[model samples]
Target: MYRANEPIDGGQNQNAATVPGVVARPRAIRDHLTPILDDLNPGIVAPEIQAAHFELKPVMFNMLNSIGQFGGSPHEDARQHIHAFLEVCDSFRQQGAHEDVLKLKLFPYSLRD
Candidate 1:
């Protein structure tokens, strides 16, 4: 049986010099793989998203808040609340703000705890 620390070929194990028990990848292979591994990493943000410009105006928040919080109230009309919200969103959309920014960021602020 061969031990992990013991050289298999008369003290000529190729990896023994670099690491006691671990093998080191060749420099060429490591260099070639680095860029591919970086691209595959999810934490890296795309250039487009990083360059995107999203401006949030206080008036937009006021408009959404004016529509009132829809907290599943039995007395409140959910459809009417939704219609008002969409109407406010449309007004902002016509004014050059992205719909996704309005929905994702400001919509949460419109909700009540």
Candidate 2:
């Protein structure tokens, strides 16, 4: 369609948007947190201060194992996985493409390949 003084309608007259190069999206835990802890080391600087040293990792072993063990408690594992998965999705939605959030909901676990 065209007006008296207007040009004829042509959908091909428009230019397409330029897309940027393939980008590596920032991962919250891997990119940000790991850099901070990359050079970190655990050591006691004060031996005379009478400070209590407890290994938190080994201490939580029983509780952590009880969550995912077969016939132990499947509910806890599901909750933890759901929470972790949603946290990653939320992080992506905040910084990365929101469309990627849809893919986050689909974790590939159905095949060994």
On lDDT, the candidate that comes out on top is: 1
Clashes of each: 0, 0
Which 10-residue span in candidate 1 carries the lowest summed lDDT? Answer: 43-52
Residue pairs with backbone atoms closer than 3 Å in model 2 (clashes) = none
Candidate 1 C-alpha lDDT tens digits along 1-113: 55455555646666545446654433566676666664475753323223246677789889988889888778988789778877887787523444655665666666676
**Each prediction's TM-score versus the true structure:** 0.47, 0.22
Model 2: per-residue Cα lDDT over 35-106, one tens digit each: 566677865232232224322233233333433323325344555655554453343322232434333323
- Please list the residue runs of candidate 1 whose C-alpha ends up more than 4 Å from where it truly belongs after superposition: 1-51, 94-98
Deviating ranges (above 4 Å) for candidate 2: 1-76, 94-105, 109-113
Scored by CA lDDT, what does every candidate get? 0.65, 0.36
lDDT, model 2, position 28: 59
